[model samples]
Target chain A: MSVDKTTVAKIARLARINVPDERLEPLAAELNGILNWIAELDEVNTDNVEPLASVTGHALPMRDDVVTDGNRLDDVLSNVPEGASGFFVVPKVVE
Target chain B: MSDLLGLNAVAARDALDKKAISAVELATAYLGAAEATAGLNNYVALTADHALAMAAESDKRIASGEAGLLEGLPIGVKDLFCTKGVSSTACSNILKGFVPPYESTVTANLWAAGGVMLGKLNCDEFAMGSGNETSAYGPAINPWQGKDKVDLVPGGSSGGSASAVAARSALLATGTDTGGSIRQPAAFCGVVGLKPTYGRCSRWGIVAFASSLDQAGPFTRTVADNALMMTAMASHDAKDSTSTQTPLQDLIGAVGDGVKGMKIGVPKEYVMDGMDNEVVTLWEQGQAWLRDAGAELIDVSLPHTKYALPAYYIIAPAEASSNLARYDGVRYGMRVDAETLDGMYEATRAAGFGDEVQRRIMIGTYVLSAGYYDAYYLKAQKVRRLIKADFDAAFQTVDALLTPATPSAAFPVGRKIDDPVTNFLNDVFTVPANLAGLPGISVPGGVTSDGLPLGLQVLGRPFDEASLYRVAGVLEQAAGFTMTPARMAGGAA
Candidate 1:
C-alpha cells in the first residue's frame, strides 16, 4: 500500500534506473499514488473471473515454422551497437 | 488547395480522383508547409523522396485505372509505426538509430492501399507520457497558441501527428493508442481521432508497449476523414497474431447512417469526483445534441470504472517492463561501449532513456518483479477482465457508450509531470475501451472554459467500428467546431 525508501531503492536497482537519495521521497510518493489508484481494484469481486491477457479469446496464432526473415541481415545489423564479422561483439564474458 | 488541411480524407481523396490535385502536389504542399515550420518538432523524419516516389506511382496507377479509394492520398505515419528504411524511434533516444528491416503491417497496409507516406511523426518516448514533453526528440509545440503566447502542448503520445494535422503539415496522420494517446491529443489539438478495436489493426513491427491493449488508428481534421483513414488502415494481418479475421466495414457508408434510434449510453461512473466543470458541461451538451437528433440517451453502468485506471497502471507497466527489456545495449540503439556486459546494459539504458521512460520502466519492473507478480500484474489482469465484462454487460442495454475523453483540457506541460499518478489518471476514461478491445473515437465537443478544446469519446462493441463512426459523425455535425492551427500565426501558447 505504501512504498518506502528501501523498496524504492530495490525497485530502482531491478529497473536499472538511478534515483538519488533526495529524489526517493518524491518517487515514493509517486509510487504510492499509483498503488493507491491500483488499490481501488480491490473493491470489485473477481471471485470467479478468468484473467484476460488478450480481449480476443483466441490463442496466440502460430506462423509457419519456416524461417522467412533471413535476407535482411545487413539492414538489421545496420544499427547494431557493436559487431564484427556478422556477429554482435560484446564484452568477453568467458575470458 | 492550401485550405485542404481542413478537408477530411474522403474529400481529399475525392479531390485527387477528380484530378483537382495530384497526390504529389498535395503531398508537396504539406511537405513544404511542414518544412517551413520545422521548429515544432512534430516530425522525427520526413520521407520527402519516398513520399514523392509513392505519389508518382499512385498517379501512374490512377492513370492505369488501378487506383484504390486511398490512391494518391498523403498520410503522416506515426513514428511508432515501423517504416521500412526510415527511422522509427517512438521519439526515444533508446531507439535512436533503430529502423525496422520490414514495415509494420499497418504501414504496409496503408501503402498497399496507395496511401503516400509523408514521414514518421514524433511521439512520447515509447509512447509513455500524456503530454508530448516526454519525447527525447523534444516536445512538439501545439500549433495553436493562447493570447498570452504560452507554448501549448499537443497531447501525447500522438502529439506530433495531432500538431502536424492542426498545422496543415499532413492531410491525415496515424496514431497508436495503448491508453488515450490518439484521442486525447486529438482533443487537445482539436482534431478527430479514432482508436479502433484492439485487434482492428495489426501490431507486427510496431515497437511494443502493452501488447494486449495497444492499437494503431488515425488522426485527422474531420470525422469523415478519420473514417476514410480507418478503413484504409484496418485489416487482418496474418503476421500480427492478434489481428482480427473479421471483415473490415465500409466506414464511409456508416457515416450518413447518423445516430437516429441508437441507444447512447452515458455511464454515471465516469462522472468522477472533482472533474473539470467545462468537460462536464460539454459532455452534457454533446448528449443533448445527440438526444435532439433522435438518439435515446440512457444511463449505462460500467460499475468497474473505478478499477480501470488502477488496473491499467498495473497491466501497462508490467507489460512495458518486459517489452522494453529487449532494448539492452546488445541490440540496436544508443549504446555505451562499455568494458563489460553488465556495464554496457546499465550505461546504455541509463544514457538512452528519458526520465519519464525510466520511471515507467522502474514501476513496470517492480510490479512484475518475482515477489510482487501476483499482487500487482496478475491481479491487474483479473481486474482487466472484469472491466471488459462490465462493458460487455453494458452493451447489452445500450448501442454504444459515451464519456469525457479526459477529465479536463490539456494542462500546461509541467502541470502534472512530477505527479506520475495524476498523469496516469489522465487515461482513466479512455483506458476501459482498450481493456475491453472496443472501438472508440474522440470527437471535438466544444472548448473548455479556458478556451482549450473539449473531447468526448464514443465507445462501441468489439469490431463495431460502423456504429462508432455513425455516432461520431452525429456529434461532429452538431458540435460544428472546426479547428485549424494556421489561424495561430506563430505556434504560440
Candidate 2:
C-alpha cells in the first residue's frame, strides 16, 4: 500500500517524466501519504457494486461519416514548436 | 468617471439595451480595469483590440435592434477554455504559447451571444492545483485581504475567473470545475460560481484535464448573472459526444422562481471534523434562510461523502495522465530536444510541467499501472458509484442539499504550498457534487470576522440547475452580502 524511492522513480519513468534521483525519496514519501489516505476506499465493500465508468448515461450521438474539418494544413501545424513544410519537427527516430 | 467597470453584467446589459452606454464604452472600461488590476496576476492575457472589435460589432447589432441575450457584456475566459487567436495556455508552461486554432464550445457560445472577451484568466497548471499557486504564470492573489492586510490566494484552477469578477475587472468569467475549481475560487472571491451537470456544457476545445469530471461553468458577481451566463454557455455540441441532448430549462427565468414548498436537505455528514466554525455557522444560517423562504428542511445523510475525496484523487489523476500524455512535445506546445524520442518526451514533459502537474501525472500513472489498476482505478470507480447513489437517495427525499462551499475562507498565499494533502482538503465539500455529476452553486454566505468572504453551496438534482439557481437567489437575498474586497481594481477606496 506504500511506495518507496525506487517505486517512485519507476512511476515517474512510466509516466515519461524525468524525476531527479534525490527528489525520488521525497516524492515517494508524498505519494505514500496520498496512497495511505486513498487506502480508505479499500474498506468499501464493492461486492456486486458496479463501477461508474461514465458520469452521464446519455447515448453517444451518432454522426455522418464525413469530414467535418480539414484542408487547412497551416492551421493544423500552426502551434508546432518546430515544423517544416507542414510536418511537425521531432528528434530523429530511425537510423 | 461613471464607474462602468463597477457595474455587474445584468446592470450593464440593461444599460446597453437602453443605449444609455455603448458596447464600445463598456468594453473600454473593462479593458482598463483588467490592466489596472494586473498586480493581482488574475489574467494571463488581455485582448484589448479584440474586445474593442467585438464591442463595436455588438454596438452595430444593437443599432439594428438585433442584440442577443448577453449583448455588450465583457467576460473573462479561464485559460482552460480555448479562445481562438488569443494565447490559451491553462496557465501551464507545457502549452506555453500554444494558441488554439479553434474556440471552445462554451466560449464560442458566449461570443455568439454577443459577449465580449476581456481577456484570458489564470488557472492552475492544467487545472491541477487547489490553490492558484501552481500556475506557471503565478497565482492570482485574492482581491480580498484580512485585517492584517496580508495578501491571500484566490482558490485554484478557476482562481483567475473568480478573482477578476470579484475585483470588478470582468463582469462575468468562464470557469471549469473538475474538483471544486470554480466553486472554491468563487467562495474565496465572494462571487457566485456554478458547476452545471457534467454534460450541461460541451467539452470540445477545452484543454482536457479529467475528462469525466471537468465541467465548464461561470463566475459572476451575482447568482442572476451566473444563471444568465449558463444559458449562453450550455449547449449540445455535436463535436462533444458527451454533451447532453436533453433540452435545457429557462435558466434565466429560474433565478426569479421561488423555492416555495420545496424540500431542502442539510446533509449531516458535510459537517467535517476540522471545518472552520464560521463556515459551520454559515451552513446553519443557510438552513434558516431556506426555512424562511418556505422550504421545508430535512436532515439527510450522504455517508459515502467521506470517501469521495480519495476516490476523486484516484480517478481524476488517472484521466489527467491519459489526457496530458498528448503533450509529449509532439503536435503542439513546448518541446525539448534530446538524442532519442523517449529522451525528448522525458525532457519535454519534465521541463514543461510544474511540480503539482508532475505529481498528479506520476500518481495517475501509478494507479493505472498493471499491478495497481484493480485496487486503485477500478475500486475508485465503484466508490464513485456509491457516492452518486448517495446523492440519488438523498434527492429522493429532498430537492437539494445546502452545504458550505469551501472548508475555510481564503487563506494567505502559499499557506499550504508544501502540504498538498492539506490543500486537497479545501475541496472536500465541493468535490462530492462533481462526483455525483449534479448541479451546485456557491453564493456569498457571509464574511469571517477578519472580513474575508465565505460562500454557501447548494447541490441540486441532475440537469436541475434551475433549482440551484432558485435556491441560490433566495440564499443571496437573505445573506445580504453586499461588500466588495478592499483590494479591488484601481484599489478599493
Best by TM-score: 2
lDDT of 2 by residue, B74-163 (tens): 999999988889899888899999988889999999999999998999999999977788999988989999999888999988989999
- Chain B TM-score, one value per candidate, order as shown: 0.96, 0.99
Candidate 1 lDDT over residue span B1-493, tens digit each:
6565445678877788887778888778778868877887888899999999999999888878888867988888888888888888888888887877778988888899999999989889899888888888888888766555577788988999988887778778999999999988998888889999988999998889989889999998888878888888888888888889989888988987988899999999998777898898889998998998899999988888888888888888888988998888776888876777777777788788887777778788888888788778888889888888889899998999989988877766555355577677678788888888898999988886556787889999988999988999899889998655533322332
User: Once superposed on the true structure, which residue ranges of model 2 sit more than 4 Å away at CA?
Assistant: none
Docking class of 1: medium
RMSD to the native, candidate 1? 2.2
Model 2 clashing residue pairs (backbone):
none
Estimate the TM-score of every prediction. Answer: 0.95, 0.99
TM-score of 2: 0.99
